[model samples]
Target: MSEPGSSVAAVVVAAGRGIRIGGGMPKQYRRVGGQAVLTRTLDALGGDPVIGRIQVVIAADAAAFFETCRAELSPAVADKLLPPVEGGATRQDSVRAGLEALAAAGAPDVVLVHDAARPFVDSELIARAVAAGRDHGAAVPGVAVADTIKLVEDRDAIGRVRETPARENLRAVQTPQAFAFGLLRAAHRAAAEEGLHAFTDDGALAEWAGHAVVVFAGDLRNRKITQPADLIEADRAFAGPSATGSGAETAKDIAMTTYVTRLGTGFDVHAFTEGDHVWLGGVKIPADRGVLAHSDGDVALHALTDALLGAIADGDIGTHFPPSDEQWRGASSDRFLAHACTLVRARGGRIDHLDITVLAEAPRIGAHREAIRARIAEICAVPLTAVSIKATTTEKLGFVGRAEGLAAQAAATVRLPEDAEADPVDAQAETAMRQG
Candidate 1:
């Protein structure tokens, strides 16, 4: 385990061909939400303040494709990114190669090993992994298993269920699995020395090496893009706010069925409280007083979250995260916005744009406008060019004018598949897919 201020790095394994996805290029090279899957994964890791450096493992012949995707990343991510390392034939081999590279370049105290195909990872998950890794030598993120799992015997034409595992004790694990850099490196070396290359994940390898690994809470939206339809869904979720907007370039690849455009608007208000700063659009801005609310009181993000939910006919933020829920007392509003975005994508919808207006007389937003826009863009997994944030005062006429509180209004535009408009048609499609 590492110390309080230990250095942290990440290794993104992107070398696999991903044949099941059926794209001419590797699945990591596929575009999702206007960005390459690998690029998005890198951004998600690099954007977090806890992670210091990132190294990517790519196929030997994919340098050109990797560079093309690399060029499109946010400047901040590019700065933390290291030169790509050549990966091996298997996922295990790729991770070992990455670890070796980091060891050669001065190993960090902790290393987060992640798959390039899962691009929806967020800062909260990363923070949890880091903390768990620090406390334990190894850690992985997991969600509770919602469905009964069967142990099957596949010796015959049709597999037979041997036993059913209790769902309460089961967990579905995902990565950016975290580990103490030295422990993981040593485990990989030991496994290689023993000719053990079949371990599915680093956590398993560590467990085999006799290290205790813990599982932390994971985000549901951190799904892997393993199939063709997953790519389509990710693309829709990341689509720009307009056909001619940032995601226009990839629209042709995503629109596989009839779609309908939708618009949703939301408004929120928060009174002033005694504090030094306030949160806005996921960016913490210096202010004379903070806003009073259940969450961090990010008016801009709350309105945007509600707007996104509205676009998909989902309930408002209050319905999803009630004010009475103590669990959400100081929750970050970005989580709320991301959840809303996930709901939109789950229904095969694409976000076209998000426009927000902030009303306040004190703690002017003029200086933080671009920062706010960038933060919103990151949270929504959209391009900064696609998010619009504007601020104006109430002209000293109302509560905002008298500096009593801050208010924000937001509008969201989205495009959803036609089947989403009719429940029966969507249900029919689901049934047909299952039968086929």
Candidate 2:
């Protein structure tokens, strides 16, 4: 493949032979779900839209192993991966070798340095890192330390525990640390010239090279798979009974977050156009004229119906109940709102709350607000406190002031829970997958 700019390239460090896991093969080639771990790592990087090409580094003898592993890759990613290059004995040395390959291939504006051990990096983090490199020349994805840390001195004899490090000043670093092509190249070249190889990670190399590295919030989902247990947890995270997982997990991994969506709308027009009495919030208010519409035209009911449907991802009243319906041509609209609430519950979704606002210059909606609220709540199958009916005029504007038509708007929030079951379908899928 033709070489690309540094910005478009990634040096995936897969050289480590994790002895702790005790797998005969290097941990990078260890299988997960019948696929090599490194393959999954590259899958995530290649899946990132911002990334263009990847250069994976492995121990010299591991080239043949990567070849056998390549068969496991999805067709889409197999083409993007460059041939594995031999790595140096140390992690830093392997990184330098990968960088050299990138430079020779026509370095992009920036290069991402990542350990192949982490596979859950998300698109947002990738976009942020690349954006930072474009804007600031170097950036590393990291999260702040939430626990107290301490610094100790002297081991053997007393093994004295020393001072407690200030918690406010600590941050735990993680990878896919990205850097501008020139800056990273310069850091490596400078370190080589000085015979220095002491830095633990590439971002620290930037700091030692007198470059200020920027830190951005990183997703906790991006975890390093240092042991077999980590892989099990990762599997559970991506595909498992996590829907009923703890709130702490929800707070950490936003992808697992579920949101309740709701909506409401209203329409009102005073028939004061040429009549007596008016309809407000399902009630006929004593007035010189009633609301002007083919039907009693309760603007409050229309608004509440729209809100309930919107909350549950259902269609609006206009779609379900067209004015063309001669039966509803002059029929009561309170029934429409009731039907909407039922539709919401039928889908395992519930209307948590609703509010409607009516705009009319007359009929005094203020004093009648409470009575309207109670009536609508009973009609809509919700608590009076959970539903609010309000009225306000635009200070006499448009058709509202001229008393041509009354308009109302409403909003609602609904919560839905999926009906996942232990029935045959779920059981079959689970059993088949476990058997694999």
Candidate 3:
């Protein structure tokens, strides 16, 4: 047992290759919500005032990858991090290595074992796990199972139903599992001596060692990312509106009533010059001639930026970054679109969708359509499905048909809080009520 009011340490297991995710790099190193998965996990742990020290367990060959993840962390969190130790093949072995490393450095009174892939583990859950561990010496977070679970006799192949477990008594376990430092260390050592290394979780191992483990309430949103769909869902959760204070309202209600929708349209044209290639939608295409313009002349992005500004009743691109400015000479058009997105977010608005049509006769847009769509989505920080790009020709009827220049027209749909001042009738009614 730990002494009263002793500090807490944490071990984050991030050494798994994440083969199921199928990303070339490990899933922990993959970008989630503009930051690495490991970075977000560290940030979550660092936010908790109860946790004093943190040790990360990573693969031996992932030193460079871990360093890149560390660089993205804030100074305060980075300072609390101990030098990472190399992990073993199995998760149990990796955790044992981490516990040994912590013991070598003078272990804390309590320790929490967490997964780097579960980035949504909030501070409230951590507090619950810590409190339970302090009381019970060993504790794991778990949520009661909601669905019927069946046990199969021959689990690997076609089998018969052996039994069905009561849903009320069953639980789906999650991390960060907490334990008293000395007790957990001894338990891990005993397991190694007994050659008991195949246990899936520390709670099971603790039970095997004859220690009573308590279960604490776990969060529904605290999901582990094991596949690509999980990553996509995690990203969507980050992008969606938080459900902090919307009492008794569904997500759809909050989304619909919180903002009023507006649409804006923009068109841009650029003449071809005597160079090799032209820029369109932030992608440089191999063309017969470059665009004659003050900037790189990405018609697709320029039109989209203008449409975004128009949606919010802001001025056009010329008003913000005038062609007269020397700094914008040869500047990338992506900056313009990004600035528009920033303004939308600053006003608590979201760009719901962007539709663009490119009118050109040369260079074949069909081959580059998907790339353009993806680039726009990245610039706007929206999903690819929210951005649409199409192309057409005028059948040799105009300058575009003659292959002398290209044109792009875009429409942007955005949602923002309805402006009270813009509705004069409502304002007048409110004024009358106040005066009366």
Candidate 4:
């Protein structure tokens, strides 16, 4: 049993290919609201003061992708990140690999195994999981079944209901499944020894190993991203009124009294080149040809950044990170946008919304639209709903129609405090004259 406030660690599983989502990159690496799903997951876990360390399990071939996501992490969270380990053929295998990595690093008193796709897991949920793990040997978060479930038996494409399970006794399980580190490690090894590797969740594995797994309350917002529709719903859910609550209302009220709103528009274009990929909205899409540019060639991010700069009456992307600068030749466009956001914040301003439209003839944006929107949201540090990304073609009429280049247009809405409107130099000169 773990002592009160025992050291806590987390193992994030993110090795799945995520083919069901139908993108070139793995689903975990895909952006939601401007950040990778895995990055958000890590932020939730690492931001929790209770979690002492974190180990991520990813595909061996995804080292580069993992590093790119890691670069976007907050410094405090990045400090807690351990070197990632490679996963195996199954989820069980992957968990075992993570467990082994933790053990090698000196396992904590408790561990939480989380799904990388579930980015909405909050610190409260993480604390609950940890507390439950301390009390019980193992615990899994779960929610009451909202819909009646049927135990079905399918034969030759025919299905028959065997019986209806009691809804009261049934719970829909979720992760950050917590356990005494030693107990979970031992159970995993026992399952391996017995060749029982088919368990879908660690809770089931613990039960099979004769350990009672307790069910704790789970958050509904912590739904895992699995299909394309899930991404759409998640974007909508995050953007909905419930998510913003009084915060949006308060912002609006403040803007009405002490803030001024500004709007700016920007446009960018990039021609195709002889390469296998293109960067758009900070996501690397597998394309037949890349774009010609000094930076990572993200037309969406570039336009959005320029729009942000325009809203602030600051210079455009060229003025900030000129193409003539060799250091920024291959820089990611996320940095440019982040810098613009920083400038806005420095002026006591906030980005209210960002809308972007992409003109492309190939590499359908439909598949990567949500990811792009999510990426922009993350970069802007705004809600997913505040950002929008749309795609269209010229109908084979011009350059875009001929499949030669892509164009992106963006608009940024911003709010700045009344005090930010004052020029610091003027204010200083006025103060000096008065004193004199």
Clashes of each: 4, 28, 0, 6
lDDT by residue (1-436, candidate 4, tens digit) is 2357578889999888887897546788765443467876787778778888999999976775676567667899899989999998899999999999999998899999999899888877887898899899899999999899987887546688999999999999999899999999999999999987777799999999999999999988788999998765554443343432111222223222256899988999999999999988888899999989999999999999999999888889999999998999989999898888777755657677899999999878888888887777667656577888889999899999999999999999987766666668888999999999
Q: Tell me, what's the RMSD of every candidate?
A: 18.5, 25.9, 8.8, 9.4
The full ranking of all candidates by TM-score, starting with the best, is 4, 3, 1, 2
Q: Residue-wise lDDT of candidate 1 within 158-231, one digit each (tens)?
A: 88999998898888999989999999999999999999888879999999999998989987878899999898
Off by over 4 Å in 3: 1-122, 130-139, 144-149, 154-160, 164-169, 175-215, 219-259, 324-326, 346-350, 395-402, 417-436
- Candidate lDDT scores, in order, read 0.84, 0.71, 0.82, 0.83
lDDT of 2 by residue, 241-315 (tens): 332211123424423223345444444343445667777778888877665576777877887788777666567
Best by lDDT: 1
Error in Å for residue 272 of model 4: 25
Instruction: Answer with 2 or 3, whichever has the higher TM-score.
Output: 3
True-structure lDDT of candidate 1: 0.84
Best of the two (2, 4) by TM-score: 4
Instruction: Report the Cα lDDT for residue 186, model 2.
Output: 89
Candidate 2 regions exceeding 4 Å error are 1-6, 155-158, 238-436
**How many backbone overlaps does candidate 1 show?**
4
Top TM-score hit: 4
TM-score to native of every candidate shown: 0.56, 0.53, 0.57, 0.59
State the lDDT at 185 in candidate 4: 98
Report the lDDT tens digits of candidate 3 across residue range 1-436: 2346698999999988886786455788765544567877888887677888899999976775676567666788888889999998789899999998888887998899999898888878888988898899999999989889999988687889999988899989999999999888889889989987887799999999999998999988788989899877665554445532111224453332246788989999999889898888888899888889998998999999999999877899999999999999999998898888777655656667899999999767888888988778767756567889999999998999898999999999988766521446668898999999
